[model samples]
Target: MSGAVSWIYLDVGLDTCTQGHDCQHICINNGSSYICKCQGGYVLNADQKTCSRSDACTQGHECQHVCLKNGDSYYCMCHEGYVLNADQNTCSRSNTCAQGHDCQHICVKNGDSHLCTCHDGYVLNGDQKMCSRKNLNLTLTFEMHVVVLIHVLMVMIASICVNSDKSYICMCRVGYVLNPDKKTCSRKKPRSSDTCAQGHDCQHICVSTDDSFVCKCRMGYVLNADQKTCSRKNSDLYKRHDVFATVF
Candidate 1:
């Protein structure tokens, strides 16, 4: 009806309301344009609208030829001839050579390796790589003559000491008597008590050589060659006395 009618108007901007919404979380608004944020451990693409995963490690920086991978990083290592450093970006030399002339065994050194060997009559212990003398046997013996000589000397010394210590009592074997000097024993003394009567009785005498003895009568007493007893030699005076007594 052409007769004055009222028209109702709705404003889109005023009516549009975002409640409990977050930028770069749920969505990002830019002049009627929107974008979504990437998750953790990821980055947005160059378009800034789409999300793409980030590559922190690229090119050779990612890992070495010989390396292990972890959550977000890697480690570098080398072979026998090379050694890796703390940074994991470089390598260095290893000490495998012997020091000075102290090394006796043959030594071989690689970039990061070492070995040792011993010369003749020697041996080397592991890890230490040092040489040492080999074990050997020792022999010893004693000659029979030497042993006999030592025994004889000891016996002589013992006898001298015993003789010097005891003065009154002398060492004498059976069938023997101590000489006047008290240093030796003579076997000339007879078993009869009459021969040894006064300590110094001279009934018999002995001649000693080496380790043997011989008995003989005193000068005045003649030994009846039979060794029975001492008797006076045949005398002319004794015979005449016998004749005179008979005549009487």
Candidate 2:
């Protein structure tokens, strides 16, 4: 017989197909070789055997705020009260009122965003943002009305001024002119004293001239339209006034 001629054949390719083989993600067998692949949000690493996050924000890939990956795509996001800028990666402030800022009179920038504020004689409402008249329920007695009328009459007779808060002051006291403070009276210069010494209430700079003093602002500030106050030149100084009314 030919028993001594019998031989055996081995399938080497099947021996190499061991589930995922040595791949970090998925491995496909091709009889004689294999290949590695990754799932969504990941890509084959440099070694071609492992996977890495595809949305990594490093080097050329960057995000102004945050970057996220989902199924081969990525997106940029910004903090509250901000919206994606024209660049798509950066952010900018959104409309104050649209973002829930309840400003009754004006909305001014606080930092990257804005805040609600009210004009003089107004107070923040229960919402803590909207503004409302503080003394809405105010009532005057007969005697108080009489007194107010008398003060008004005096103001008219003396050529003085009276504010809504019942504040009264002489616009031009005898021999004196209205000072930069508006509440105080200043004497014309060329006299024995210097009116600039009265603290013109000029927030930034004050310069004395021949007869009176001029109110000036610092380098980065501008003289308010009133020509007596100072405000930041880069800020919206002309916006609605947002200070409490006080008696002069």
True-structure RMSD, every candidate: 23.5, 25.6
lDDT string for model 1 (1-248, tens) is 77997897744354121532333433644333445677775566666545545554542363334665444555666655556767776766646573323356787774455667788656686555787755422111133233335337655331121212212233554565656765444565444433333333224764443344445676656876655456765678678888999999
TM-score for each of the candidates: 0.27, 0.35
Candidate 2 residues lying further than 4 Å off, grouped into runs, are: 1-60, 93-98, 112-114, 119-248
lDDT of 2 by residue, 97-198 (tens): 566665668887676667777886677777757877655225444544554574576563323444355333436547667766654445554552566886
Whole-model lDDT for model 2 versus the true structure?
0.65
Residue 155 lDDT (model 1): 52
How large an RMSD does model 1 have? 23.5
* Cα lDDT over the full model 1: 0.52
Local accuracy by lDDT, each model: 0.52, 0.65
Where is the poorest 10-residue window by lDDT in model 1?
158-167
